[model samples]
Target chain A: MHPIGTVHYLVLSVALLLIGTFGVLTRRNIVVILMSIELILNAANINLIAFSRAVDNVNGQVFAIFVIAVAVAEAAVGLGILIALFRNKETVLADEVDLLKW
Target chain B: MSQFYTSTDHFVLLPAIMLAIFGCAVLLLDFLFPEPKQRKVLALLVLAGLFFSGIGLWRQYSFLTSQGISEITAFRGTLTVDSFALFFNGIFIAVAALVAIVSYRYLELEGEHRGEYYGLILLAQTGMYFLATGTDLVTLFVGLETMALSFYILVGFLRGDKRSNEAAIKYLLLGAFSSGFLIYGFSLLYGISGSTKLRDIGAAIVSRDLWDPLVFMGLTATTVGLLFKISAVPFHMWAPDAYEGAPTTVTAYLAVGSKAASLAFLMRMFLGPFWNMKEIWEPMLIVIAVASMTLGNLAAITQNNVKRLLAYSSVSHAGYMLLGLIAGNETGIKGMMVYILVYTFMTLGAFLVVVGLRRMDVIGDDVDDLSGLMYKSPGYAVLMLIFMLSLAGIPPTAGFIGKYFIFLSLIQTGHYVLAVIATLYVAVAIYYYFRIVRSMFIADLVDKAPLASSVGLRVGLYITGALTLAIGVYPEPFLRMAQVSFGR
Candidate 1:
């Protein structure tokens, strides 16, 4: 059996990031957009942990933990803001929250 | 050889640690006294914490300079204390202090006097300190996110208002997207170099003579994230809404504090680890600089909302600072530092004026709100005139001095065409900046109500107003400080 390699990990990471980005850009549901952002962040974690294994170093793994903590905090704040918006507007569609614009 | 840790290792983080502690103290104080009016006490407490942190930073700065130590790296290169970081630390601390002062009465009148506001501001300042000083990519990422997350909550602090909620959500969605891009870029950088420390990354790239598609992609993604934070054109869609909808004081803090912090991070990252790859990133920055100036000034001309107009003006000022990066030399960096310092004074002073006019009856954020302001308060009107003129880059103001340094640096670097274009936009900017002035002095009074004033707002105006004029008159000390900030 062939060994797992950096290339394989990077391919998977990039794929996840692209999918997440696509979802964020295309989706209108605020909840889905938040989830998409989480996916993008998890994609980064995958890259960090994979590169940590390949590089034989702990820095990337340490960074991955930090990333996870920050992602959770971001999600909490993002949801709080979303809830605030929903309370006032009664909907979470991105287009409806258009009280401010050019 | 392995290195041993010592007491000095912890000393380097003293300012940030102290600031974090102060933030927690504010939270505790708020828990004890949950009354809205008690928020003023919390604000004063935050100021005291800021004062102590400022003194700590000053002592560290003095110690380092006195010992002739140009750089001190601690926590195994994750953090570096140097004049560059110290300079930015001072700016961030000053901004936090000034914002606290200005927000006092503004929050009281808006009925949004929550203790979390001061706590979050202090927390955000700590994050900014780390972002400016972090020498490791991991530290930088954490710091940036810390600052950004605090801002997300702060922007929506006025949760009762529909516009504030809208601003918060829009800023969050866009900000999170950009952070994803930034993190992915950092991941790629780590993969390519196999290190997260900036010095080690520079060494690895130089040793391998590395250049590849991945590197370019990573750099581009990182630049995009930073440009968004600074509200540069093509990435400035969130700024105007965020600025206009946020509580006036938060908008000022967001405008001056966040931009300076991100640019400080950008300068460190680009000039340190990626200096070898300048050719790849420099052209992209130049294009961003040009687009930001043109689009920012042109769009600002049509804005009737004063906050939105200043938001656009902030974008254009970001463009001017980017020119310093384009110069890509020592003088350029010095000029960038001076430009940001002066920009902080003028922008904050201008925003504080907007906040000064705010009352329960009137939002006081519209251009028409300023009509006949001269008749109501001659002192504030004169102060606004000074800030407006400075912002227009007219002579005898710090804004002019800042622009002069940037253009001179550009000319020194043979960016003649860019300088010429920037000057033309400065002319365009004057037209818009003067629009408010004309309304204040010439137009009929829309509402003859006496302008509401406060002690906090007055102090803020005086400090920033004096600094703007003083720097313009005697720029030698600031210029010298900028020169010394190379942190060599």
Candidate 2:
């Protein structure tokens, strides 16, 4: 059996990123879109950590830590906006939140 | 793995540090006061913070010049202080101050004069300062997020307004989605170069001869995020709705301050790290610029909402600025910087006039709302005419000077076809921009009521209007300033 390498990690990361991108484009529910965004970020985290170990440098790991912290802030803000929308229009679907469309 | 810094390094960071502290102070004071009328005090505090930061920035700029130090990279090259950053720092401070002044009357009119509005603007400006000055990918991403998160809340500040909430949600989702692309791209970039410092990455790529497919892919993905931030075409779907739905003052800040900061980051990364790969990236930018100009102008012609029209106009302006980057020379870069400064005034002044009309009887954001504006408020009509003509890139306004520099660089670089295409789009731009002026001056009056604009709104409008004309008439000083900015 082949041991895991940078290539394997990169492949996994790309696959997850593609999945998240698909969810963002296809899903109508805002919650699902938010989840997809999280998935996309986590995929980046996996790549960062993998490269940190592979390159014998901690910079990638440090970047991953910052990414995680920002993700938390982003999640809080996203949900807050989601709740605000739900309160006003009684919907969580992106299609329904279309009052300001050109 | 701790890094040490000297006192001078702290001095270098004074402006951003001052902005952050003042932001929190504004929030605390607002909480203590907690009255609608008292919100004006909070706005004043925010302005004072911005004022002091501007002073700090000026002192820093003089210190750098007097010391004869061209650039200083502190924290292991994570942050940089230089003339380029100082130029943007001035724009950010001015934009923040103007936004605060305009917000005072806007919040009062909406009867939602919360302290957080002012606090959030300061925080966002702080983030902008970092984005402009940061030298490392880590600093850049964190700064971008800080600004993005603040904008998310500010866009939805009017909780009772459905449009504002929708705008906030859309902006938040799209913004977060782009962050994912941005971070993944950063990871890949780090993976390739084994460093997060932009200079180190550029060095690594050059030393290793790493112009493989993966490197190109990583660069492309990273640019996608920056492109979205600047609202370039194919990535600008969120801007129109977000701009229209946001409070008009916040919309102005978004169109001016936030976009300028993003362009600062983009130029630093591309021209600094990716300069060696100019052959690849330049073509991509050219394509994006062309599409943005064509689509933005065509779309603006159909918009009835003035805010939406301005949003699309902002997109086209982004395209024009990109022309400078594609020029890949000193003249082009200077053109980009100058155009941003001029745009800050023209866009902000136009929005202030709209805010002025959002009074007791009229919300003057619709194109039709300006019908017979010369009768109701001749002063405002004339000011709006200056902004509209400037936006259309007519002469005798700063906008023309800005566009002239951009076109000069394009022609100098032999991008004649792109220049011609852009010129035709300028014609389309005039039709729509003049539509507003025609409605106000040429069209018949619908209402004879006098518009009541507050003193704050008047101050904001007059200052920006005066600056627009002053820069246009005497372009020499500004042109020299832009020339001196790059230190080349």
Candidate 3:
């Protein structure tokens, strides 16, 4: 019940990052993997904003805005690639996209 | 507003701006000239863009030398114009030009010769420029994404091929995932420094406790991200697959151009911000370097696919360059730069031969596909031999010069164990590299088809092959350039 603090935001964002990393590693669906990447990106955005406020500096906030724009671009490219894969392979499952072997 | 900008800023940005303008022009002109025959002009336009960009880089170099300064900062220090950037830009432009030239015939063969392909190469080179020059976190992150996004699209340029599609998605997922790690680290760095500029962050880190958890976490995350970009071991799962599946021309470009840019970025970050905590990161990189060399060489021995073999070989090359950095001496840094330049030509030359083998029916990526290449095309077969010998770090080739400096640096730094281990891997590398040679000369022909030769392909091969030998024979000038670029 103490006033919200930077440490509190750090903990929350770290949790989101861990969850996103976990999702990306464990998920089979390429779409889910892409969403997990978004979560990780948002987690970074939250950290940037929180730290910006803590330091009374605006660069981190500006960085967060850039991060948001970049995240959108990344998602667009990821999905475009996804659609292409689907067109050729007829599956969005990561397991099925395995034409090239290790 | 007048005070906020200056001629220096415009001057520093001119090269990248030129690349961007040409990139867009290529894209727009493609729309006007939809015919495949006309699309060939786009390749020439890309070369022109690269040519002009090279001129811009030369102007920057002359300005620095004439002013008797090593570097000039622009956009209020967000961008830096320096020998280090100029050196790497030289590599990127050379790689892009070679790739563009060879791509014409390959794309025509694939029937996917579109304008966007050349456009993306220019745009990616533009991104690499920022990566080499950017001193701010915002600039670096955007630059990395620009380069990565273009490569992702290019990897999948063969829209009809499933392998290309799969390679693109894998590359995209892993690349985006790595970027996530990179930005999370950058956020922590900003928090710790209260600024997004790398110099500010470095200054702040100098004052902080070495073992601070935030410092440790930020360092680890950033290292992971950069390592992933360079395809270091444990984070290199996407490399072989991407290299094997990508259009041969794009694969060569990705292997050389992208790796060179990422190495520039890595050197900037480590030597700039995280340099103070060398005690922590040096050991970590040591482990990564050893693992990369050991695993990369060992894994390569079993590959029948020449593309995958070269892919693994590149992974090992990354390890050798890391050793140069870990030495952390002037010689070590100079050696790293020299190695990158040498590696570019040899690797591209090797791939150019493979590209020539891509007849209308032949994928030509298998080891057996190279059987009796000596008999089929003696010019290309001899060129491939020089490339392989160079790759194996034999004397009288540019690769030996690179490896020699790297090992000498390690020995000078008293990393005798690491140097010996790295040298041992060259033996392993030779085993695989000669496998290609054996196939080309000793093995019987599987297919007697003549290589799909064109003026552009032959020209590209000649440039790469000649440089590979020229640098090896008279490395003094190139070595001096590397030393100068290292600012010594």
Considering every candidate listed, which one attains the maximal TM-score? Answer: 3
Please, what are the lDDT tens digits per residue for candidate 1 over residues B321-418?
99998998787888899999999999999999999999888999999999998988889989999999999999899999999989998999999999
Docking class of 3: high
- Clashing residue pairs in candidate 1, if any? none
Compute the interface RMSD for candidate 2. 0.6
- Per-residue CA lDDT of model 3 for B1-488, tens digit only, reads 26667888888888999899999999999998878767878999998998888898999999999989999999888999889999999989999998988888889889999999989999999999999999999999999999999999999999999999999999999999999999999999999999989999999999999999988998898899999999999999999999999999999999999999999999999889988899999999999999999999999999999999999999999999999999999889999999999999999999999999998988999999999999888998999999999999998999999999999999999999999999999999999999999999999877876788989899999999999999999999998889888862
Question: Model 3 chain B: which ten-residue window has the lowest total lDDT?
Answer: B1-10
Cα displacement (Å) at residue B370, model 3: 0.3
* RMSD over all Cα atoms, model 3: 0.9
The candidate that achieves the highest DockQ relative to the unseen native structure: 2
Each candidate's number of clashing pairs is 0, 0, 0
Candidate 2 docking DockQ: 0.93
Instruction: State the weakest 10-residue window (summed lDDT) of model 2 chain B.
Output: B1-10
Candidate structures ordered by TM-score, highest first: 3, 2, 1
lDDT of each: 0.90, 0.90, 0.93
